[model samples]
Target: MYDFNSINDYLNTKIIGQTIIQYDNLTSTYAKDKNIFNTCPDGTVVLSENQSKCTVRFGNKWICREDKNIYLSIILKPIGKNLMISKFDVIGCSSVCEAVADTCNVECKIKWPNDVMINNNKISSVSCDFVGKSDDPSGVIISMVVNANMGTDEIDKINEEIKNSSTSLKIETGTDVHRELIIGHILNNVEKHYDEFMKQGTIISAVSSCIHNSAIVNKTISVMKRGKKTVRKLYAKSIDGEGRLVVADEKENEEILSPGETIIIYEGKA
Candidate 1:
């Protein structure tokens, strides 16, 4: 079993309230238990080994790579009543990518809603589901998976594919890194940002700084809308309070976009 010590150690270092769980695996028999396990306040994290099986039925993909990844879920009871659960996924992705870059000195990018890419290749994917909502405004549950287990050969192939698209820490610095430490660093950074966001309102200026530092701001890209036929190219101006991308066309007209909108942000003309 993977050690929960790292998570425990992190929680000890921070003022945030959290809970940690380490399990071998679980079945549907304990689904309720799993849900209850995450019902804590913000910063509560559930870490398990070979836990629940990933299935397409849940709109989740089981990305199996050796053992160089951290599969963990964080339960957060956000402070405000107006907090949008949808924004957490995007925020989590952006924060995680930034955390990885800052810790490893590698460049990373977010693929739309919740995927992280290193050197144009997929390194991590994040998915979330709302179990329930409280009338008094509780919090949200964010399940995140960070792939830190890619082998050198896998990294090489990923680098080749993303040479023109993305980058990874190992590829950039040519050094092997500890996946656990990376995961811990990411969690710590995320906690810091989450706290800041709770203190400050989610305005474009306040949040854009973090997003901009991650190289994800003001890029021209194409976004495909859900249940629609047309894909439009626009400059991703900023992300709004609702977590929608505020995109602009050639005429600088703006539009708000939700998930299922495929976006391609690169060095090409949009």
Candidate 2:
């Protein structure tokens, strides 16, 4: 469980979560994004020990068992003209990768757009919500899930379909990790890079960090589009300044993708 006092004491961010609303359980952290957007301060954070209906990109349910992972959502007001809200996904992913590495001593990688991978399997998922009427929103919600103390046995019990595709910090490090440390490190890293993004108005640092820490780029992979059956096989060339994936198909045609599933193929074989 996350100790509110310990987390608050350890948090080093300037404004990422000065005001936090924490619960032992909830339907979902971001589920209250609309309810609090009107009065919540810029860095208000909503955290829960468990979520009954946690969701991810494309409306998929995220597994949120108690005391097993990091589940929280942060509220932020849009800053700078060049600050694309989309870049926060990269920021979150990079921050998690760094935090996990720092705390667990196991290297993790980002899988384009947002998923964080450990040993070629997913260990974390990042999602964002902007509930305003227009493209420019008054507030933003950044939600994240990290598989922490959920041991290998627990992970093995997940839906058989994705059971083998996901992992946890305990599974990676063979030890029970302190959740508060992970959360504190993530908040600190997010604050550090977020300030840089707000100042530069671009994701240059985020793109570089993600590209360096990513495992999917430069690898032949399969891309599954949302609500569609068609899939594309491409080489993930890089993550552009705007956070779009730059990829090239077999025909040498270059294209950028958004909102798609990336499956890294094995050595260009299938």
User: Per-prediction TM-score, please?
Assistant: 0.75, 0.91
- Summed backbone clashes in each candidate are 6, 0
Off by over 4 Å in 2: 79-85, 260-270
lDDT score, candidate 2 = 0.79
Q: lDDT (CA) for every model shown?
A: 0.57, 0.79
How displaced is residue 250 in candidate 1, in Å?
2.3
| Tens digits of per-residue lDDT for model 2, 166-214 | 8888888988889988888888888887777677666677778899997
Worst lDDT window (10 residues) for model 1?
25-34
lDDT tens digits, residues 1-270, model 1? 555575455443353325565555543212423467444555666655544554311264544333445666666666554666446666677667766777777777666566677655656666654445545545665666665645556645543443333333455557766665666766775576576667664534324533564334577776665556776778878766666667789998877766544444445311
Off by over 4 Å in 1: 10-17, 26-34, 37-39, 55-62, 133-138, 152-176, 201-206, 213-216, 260-270
